[model samples]
Target chain A: MRRKASLILLALAVFFTALSPLLRWYAFPRLAKIPANQYQDMVLEAKNATLLDYGTMQAKTVPKVTIVQTLKGDVDAAKKIDKTAGRDVVVWDGLSYVQGPDGKMVSSIPERYIFDAHTQDPVHATGEMVDGDPVKRDGIEFKWPFLTQKRDYEYFDAQTRTTNPIHYKGTENFRGVKVYYFEQTIPWTKVPFPKTMPVKGITPESVAKTGTTRWYTTVRKFWVEPVTGAPVYGEELHKEELRGGTLLGDRDKVTAFAGDVKMREDYIKHTVALVKSNRTLVLLMVSYLPWGFLTLGLLLLALSLYLEARSRRPGDPASTEVQEPEPVNA
Target chain B: MRALIAATTGLVLAFALVLTITAMGSPMGKTSPKPLLTTVPAHP
Candidate 1:
């Protein structure tokens, strides 16, 4: 009974293991060819927007764009166009610089612009924060600078050693039309605002500190249409503090993002292909596991039996009884 | 006992060989060049 059970197990292992490769071979091609929109659009967006020196204080933003647009006028016809509209990501560098009043290029603070979801164009924007005042609305308060200010705000208070307005900035390139960039003073406050503004369920107080723990983000970026100047895509990169046991100490880290404005069709197809290939590999691996275990178990049983047979002497009762000793005393 | 073990081993070996042969015969290859479903019919 025990031997039979082992054999059954071995068979199962062999069948499963062998079947894995076949399953992978069949599945990957299908998986790899998934509609390009779902996969490629998000990947392209992620790759395009990233901060340089990600971990350091002195970080720079480098945003790259590779758009796949369908042709309308005189152009190559055979070339594959990613009909996946809204896949193009508009990247705005957070660490860009602008010439300050003293004729020095200073680190930019904050700016705003809207990008279209379908057309992927810059429709509206706030030029730059040239002036503003620090107001205390909620528990926390910071300065809100305007772009049309008379003079650029200074970062340092010479004698007091206090850092002045911390600025945020961004740039937009609207295909041959215009290249717009701006810097502004973004107020870090804790006062909640009425739900009437563009961001409904948010408040000034939520954006108080760099690593403040909250349910949602208080700051965000958006892509807009250049003509109508309406926002198309709005996204916020959120951060959270890691647990105590993790290798990274308690620090603010980007957790997740919501919304994919420029969803492309071709991108999704490409993504499916990659996913299919991975799935196929997994199936193949699983198929072989049972077979591997069975082979090892059987080999072990065979060795044990051989050892037991060899250990007994040829004339010993164990061996001699089996043959029925041939008329020993006859 | 010796005969029983030999028979069990042989049977297992035979079953294993059959399974392997079946697997080999299946049209499984590194790449399956099946046609992809690329388009959806337009809604009227």
Candidate 2:
């Protein structure tokens, strides 16, 4: 019995250890999946020094945009676009309300965004997002178990219309939460000014003849929790430059923007709340169960090894019984 | 005891193997390509 128990325990340990990674990789994607109809609030802002540096200092007001995101439906048509159907797709609708000149709140940005439940990749985006096409190629695809020393995320630029890499910087504790740090460098993109804006050196004639002069680039940093995938803090550094007046002169103009105005104020109270409030099942599946299985399996294995060794001792009845007495004979 | 342990352990191992095999055959991420790069360019 002891020998048998040992074998069983050892087998269980091996089974569990081997199963741990597979479960983590496959099960977590489904287990921790985000659901439809959940909501998130994203706020963006620009200040005085930033506006002044960007040549909009005289504007006399801080610009702010507050958007509310709501997931509307499930993967009713994910296969239509993303063939992989590897991810659960959701239809997300959004609206941004801003104070109108009359002091009444009026709707500003109305749009739709598609997202994958597993990876949180934005599949399709329209409206203001499509204008710049900034998030390129599943920009936020994160492999599950955000716990890692270093990782890279694929990001897209709207102005240049290309994809770039977001690199993991390090980890640090923020607001009592441990978080992973990542930074992405956005290469400078040629400024495409609107016809109405009065650029100092450019005449209608030069505007027609020239390609571009003013350029903008951005640096984005994120601090996210490993288990919950919640962003405890984030910041964006927006800068602009005029290369030798490529538009007309040689002096480079650079401006640094304070990105995500409202986020800085609240420290992701909304998004963090959204994550913390939801996914009871998902969190358990992704983070705890697999580890539990591994621990149980290892314990069983150790017990089994001990039993097998005890059964093999020379003084043990089972070991001696296995050897036949000099048999019979006379 | 030997009979019971042997039977139970064998059954569990077999069951685990089957589960893993099923997962492998299913539409898993492993079988799917790197989804982002594979997507058709959305830009105009």
- After superposition, the stretches of candidate 2 with alpha carbons farther than 4 Å from their true spots are A1-15, A29-38, A44-58, A63-74, A79-138, A141-152, A158-161, A185-217, A227-230, A237-267, A270-291, A305-330, B1-44
Model 2 Cα shift for residue A187 (angstroms): 5.9
Pairs that collide, model 2: A6-A304, A13-A297, A134-A158, A136-A156, A213-A247, A242-A253, A244-A249, A244-A250, A245-A248, A245-A249
DockQ of each: 0.04, 0.07
RMSD in order of candidates: 23.8, 9.8
lDDT of 2: 0.51
Report the lDDT tens digits of candidate 1 across residue range A68-180. Answer: 21111111110112222223212121111222122232222222212222233332223211112222111101111111122323332211213344222444543222212
**Candidate 2 structure quality by residue, lDDT tens digits, A1-330:** 666567667666766766666567765555444444344444443333233223432222345423222223323344344455555565544444333222333223334456676666667633224222333344653222333345776765444445678787888876556678878787777754333333355343474464435567778777777676656666666665444444434335433222343343453665555445543445565557678877877787677777788888988886554554687898
Provide the lowest-lDDT 10-residue window in model 1 chain A. Answer: A70-79
lDDT of 1: 0.30
lDDT of each: 0.30, 0.51
